[model samples]
Target: MSPQRPTNPAMQRLVDFYDPAVMGKDVGGRTLAQILAWRDTRLESQHDYIQVLFPLPEGSIFNEYSPVVDEETFLYLRHDSNDGFKRAMRRALARMLSFYGFDITWDQDAAGKWVVAVDAKKGAEEDHFPRWVRRMDHNHLRITRILRSLRVLGLEDEARAFFAALCWTFDSYRRIGDGSMKFWRRAVELPLHIAPDGTEVDWLEKYEEKKEEKAEE
Candidate 1:
């Protein structure tokens, strides 16, 4: 039987992104799985794929062609209802995490909402940690996009969990470089709530420091 296609082009592309059996392509004409299969060097060099892998409610600052997560589509992809999307999201998350020499784990609370936990990958080459954490680059912005996308797409707990991991990296990883933390803070609470440009930092316990610090070379 042929797959049931979505009437909305954006919805159809989204289905292509997170649904494995659908062979549709993102706006860039690459499937999500194809993007995921890219090596670290390609992942590092490519600028457009991040916005597609982890879309925000608003258009991407880096990639203009990015798909925005509007309210109607956002509500339709509910965590309580859509386990397949959750699984596909997990794979996407894991792909990014592993790229940065990290491993992922998941848990469920009483309500059964899935939550993500990140850890440094064990037995990684000695240089892996430094390569991922020491430099300030596009990955930092990618982190922001990932967090907000997770939240807007009905994975709030998972977003919070990922944020907690970022908090740890900011402090412990050392040399996270300048300006990354501020961008990350902005990610959790973009001007809009979960709508296009919507972000919430209400759950964060402490306010960000007014003065920023520079990481050592």
Candidate 2:
């Protein structure tokens, strides 16, 4: 069977998200066609590995251009029956991306549901890991600062929920068969928030610090 092509609507959406100028030029020294070729190659070679490493949820939309939740935990969240949780999740994700300096554009589909996409940054590096991960790490300390600001601005719930979702996403991606797992394992932990009162700390940081202290003793 022949490979499927993204329909006109999907291609138009991609063009809008990327904008004409950036999309017209190459990304990371490779044309869009070349990058897509590499992506297709990896998907083919790692199909089984991806399945075993991150099994698809029941009734998942896994084909081209469909949103996929690779982590079991995140899959649960995405499929959660709680409307509030889902709305909060969407808001949190948008807020998190905005905080990271990514321009998020949304458009209503035929059903009046929003389809969101992040505007592609120019001159961004596209390596083995997703460009999103690399950009997040580039502003690692600033991410923490943003969380603190959100908390101070009475948006602690948004911040917490965002970080929780991100932690799960990172945990899921880190478990995949990529050799960059170690880098993700370290990079992902950076956005963990610190309590302002000093009475509490990020759960992961506290656990890690205690482990190190125990080892040193």
Candidate 3:
């Protein structure tokens, strides 16, 4: 039998979230479309590793997109019981994106429930990320950006908390996967290395390690 197509509605919502039309906005005086285009340029050699959480059936390419979260997480957040967490998460993401200068908005769907909405500040070029980078790496990049943004906004303590929670979450996930530990040492301890002048710190560099060590349960 052929592989059945994924008709999960939550997957569709995830795709919509990553759509260029929805993400087109001006960030930091430069259109998000423009910045995405820049990112695409940077994705030159890393192009083939981006994995799609929701891959369409063979030969069906319309509306294809990969979001930053997996399907299970997406559905969990969208479920009725989790709406409260969903709303808070939406606000958190919107706040982070706004700090990067993107104009984000939310809209009520046909069911009278609010969903994420985005608008561009100005017309700009198109942009896309390669298919090679999966959510694991994608999320790391996002966390790094959020940390840098928080530090820039003078919320160092909050940044540290967020970083700690994020690292703990990663540790939990890795531990669940194979009773391994990867992020605890370098990642969880990163904030301690911040320099007074902010010149000696390599925020992105150390965060790239993905080694998995056995965790002492």
Candidate 4:
């Protein structure tokens, strides 16, 4: 059966960009290029302004950066409640990962049950993809793009709820510092936008203010 478009405007926006015919195929060439362009443009715009605050390498290349996750992270998505949104987001995510040269695989248990797993499609050295980007904090470019895509697809609430569930059950990450914890909490509670000086802005507040002003008018 063909994938259905979402009723929500946000999800609908994403579905519009999505090519149902190419849904499960590899995510590369034009597909990956567009998103990478979006991600890189945003980061490059802030590079000069925020360099002092978060200095990355002098010249970094992150074109090969692929955000791969463990199998268990997708377990909750199997639930009936998240059916539509999960299907959409997972497919998009899979495409994104595939574009970055990740492969979809499965893990088989002793009893013969199998579950989804992610693997690097290439066996190249880490040096070739040295600028590995992980979901260490909200400053990540790739993750932000993924979430933005989901929101554009009209899965804003569903994506947020899924993220909350994932974070709550994250059993892999070790305890980070208090500062990082604080940043993570703030990032979660509000919509994030980077400032000229690399400070994180709560765009949600700005959005509400705009809505209120419009109401007043």
Best by TM-score: 1
Better of 2 and 3 by lDDT: 2
The segments of candidate 3 whose C-alpha lies over 4 angstroms from its true place after superposition are: 1-135, 175-217
Model 4 TM-score, 2 decimals: 0.32
lDDT score for residue 133 of model 3? 20
Cα distance off (Å), candidate 3, residue 143? 0.7
If scored against the real structure, what TM-score would every candidate get?
Answer: 0.75, 0.26, 0.26, 0.32
Where model 1 places Cα greater than 4 Å from the true spot, the runs are: 1-7, 108-115, 123-125, 189-217
How far is 126's C-alpha from truth in model 1 (Å)? Answer: 3.4
CA shift of 69, model 3, Å: 29
RMSD, every candidate, angstroms: 9.1, 20.1, 20.3, 13.4
Reference-based TM-score, model 2: 0.26
For lDDT, candidate 3 versus 4, the one ahead is 4
The C-alpha lDDT values of all candidates are 0.68, 0.36, 0.35, 0.37
Sort order, TM-score high to low: 1, 4, 3, 2
- For candidate 1, the 10 contiguous residues with the lowest summed lDDT are 203-212
Task: Give the per-residue lDDT of model 1 (tens digit) for 1-217.
Answer: 2333445688768866787667568877888788889998898888888887787656766777888765445545643556777778878888988887777887887999756677767755463555557657767777877887876666666677677777787787567865777766766654335332344433221212211122221
lDDT (10s digit) by residue, model 3, range 1-217: 2222225654445333334455422212333334334443343343211222112111112223333333344334334554343343334444443322234555678999755444332421122111212234433444444454333322344445555544444453342221112332232344423422233334323322321122322
The TM-score of predicted model 1 comes to: 0.75
